[model samples]
Target: MFKKLFLLILLLGLFNHTSHAQKRIGIYSLSTISSKSGHLFGLDSDYNGLFRAIPAYCVDYFSNNADFITIDRKNFQLIENEREIQKSESFMDGYVVGQGKSEGVDLICQSVFDVDTYSLIIKILDVKAEKVLCSSDKKMDKNLFGIKDLKQQVTGMLLEISSKCFENEIPVVRVLETKGKKARKVLIAAGSNLRLRSGYKIEIYELVNEKIGNKTISRKNTISSGEILKVEDENFSVLEIYEGNEKLLELLNNNTPLFCKPTTN
Candidate 1:
């Protein structure tokens, strides 16, 4: 009886863990075409190469930097090959979603690059939801120096779109250490990787769970706030507390469960 009970408990724990696992993202092959000159046949090799680099860079960026998401590279290759065959024709939304769902990915990242106007449109689709979560349409100067310059622009655009698409998955910045008599300065466990920059405001919060009449309500209560002083590295940053400094210090000293999120203001 005890062995059976232990196995049941272990099974439940595994189920819970699986339920909260990060979403898997698959990047499709970037489609390139000329808006004015008509199709792939009219595009030069340089333009095609530059456009193809977008999806490759996205796959690398998300795989290395996005800790809160998972990338299915094996399936991405399959989808990429299929899309490449259909590059000359327009692919329907239903087909894309179906492919993503069949591959077991939760989200799909797809883009279309117009070679003539140098316009790029990126879209993030939620496979299960069968809808676009967010999208960005950016135009670039055709006179850009070379492929490197175009790559830099594409990376910036992708970062912005990614931030919007996975805003909720942005990892919480934790107070790693503190300084100052009143703890006016703090070191957090996040930096440029979180897209944090000097002068960006961060709101500190403590998650609270309350039980009321057999139901549990969870919410984040803002306990303090700060402005970024410097991004020390990819894994750390310094923040100068501007609000509720004393309370923040108290929480820090007590080692309370605190987390911070970057604010738009």
Candidate 2:
């Protein structure tokens, strides 16, 4: 009986250890661009509001996944205050990464909004490496014309970058085409170039707007998973459906906000 009790305690400790291992991500205040001039502008009251709201948006998007821990807003504000004292030039990615590391975060992220072009750009920096991990530029669709809509779109884009930051092993692949009439198979953007091979399973997620608490959060929901059937040239591969049904095929065909995450067998 004592042995069983000790084993239970050991298992609980292991769970707590693993749970705390999630990467910590820090978000800096957003920078903006002049729509007509296409040049960066100084941060104003408008930019400050956007920056303050980003943390909440980020936390909402990543809530379901325990793989990320966002830096506290007050701590992030303190970093911003320190940056002002240093009075360094703007867009200094290295400084941002350094500050993030000092604050015990593994990654740092920033967003730029182009008011004129109505585009959102998000950049993720590896704090330890002090280099860009990934950057994404997304334009607001007609459906996202409203301010609320635009913010949601930007949140989704940022979440994508954040999710990829922790997944060092999994390369993101795009769906190129759905083969056959049933669309149970898909051609992906990764192949030998990404060192992919057959018999590897991949999870696919669809971006959706979910109402969580009082906010409308944009997040990725796992819709289907598949296995690599063949790795063609350097840039393409075919995947067969190991899980999911016709609904997954339809989502892929519709050009939904979908991304593939590869897994090791």
Candidate 3:
């Protein structure tokens, strides 16, 4: 019927809107400390190659894996061109903010590699807020000695960055129903549409609020952990709790405001 068709169109529109609502991120070309120092000494060929490859790797990874983020490739190229013109790998914070705003991206990722200290520092900036959202500093592991080991170290650091930036994208579902007092299985309000898969771990938690002076702080207190047992449909999945079942059952019995999110691990 026309009514059903209209409803279907509306749902599609909403889904498209939600998909586009994801944050757009631009990654600048990797910078090096030696370049910032303006010294004649330059990084070795291997290090240079590694630095050049990192941004591409990041682009490919996000393009393939992230459903909740859009990569701003056009602006990324522009930024790289500007860097090449400047004949330097380093960019100032002001430049980063200006470029980020001009590109109209929600977030910007910048990395600085120290050739001397073997440290890779990554920073994610919020363009509208004009501030850093998160950052990570990683030093080459002592155990990792060769170029191959260095590549692995850098890859691990990049993965950490990805994890931090996309953390909010993890699907959150509400516990809809519980079997019984000793319930090990529960139904949730999310499934395949959220990219949830069987065996993916989930953590159940409740927000706890505590007052300190005139301020109230809220944090998640994990009550239980589970893994997806089945994806029944696009909007529902079943989980089997393997940890803290008693606490989870008590919370469900009392109808607590508990939420579940897929674990990054």
Clashing pairs in 2: 35-116
Give lDDT tens digits, candidate 2, residues 1-265.
9999999999999989987887787766676666565455555536546555655555554443456786644334433444333333344566677678778888776766777786767787788887888987776555353454444455446545646654422333444445453446777766654445677677776667999889998676777788888888877888887666466667755756566665432
User: Candidate 1 — which residues are off by over 4 angstroms?
Assistant: 1-19, 36-46, 65-69, 72-90, 141-144, 168-231, 237-265
Worst 10 residues of 1 by lDDT: 74-83
Provide TM-scores for the models.
Answer: 0.52, 0.53, 0.53
Which residue segments of model 3 deviate by more than 4 Å? 1-24, 27-69, 74-95, 109-124, 134-180, 232-235
lDDT of 2: 0.63
Best-matching candidate per TM-score: 3
Q: Which scores better on TM-score, 1 or 2?
A: 2
lDDT agreement with native, every candidate: 0.67, 0.63, 0.65
Candidate 1 C-alpha lDDT tens digits along 108-197 = 887767776768878888899898888877786445564434554565566557657764323334454555636677777767664567
Give stretches of model 2 more than 4 Å off.
34-40, 45-52, 74-91, 142-148, 166-265
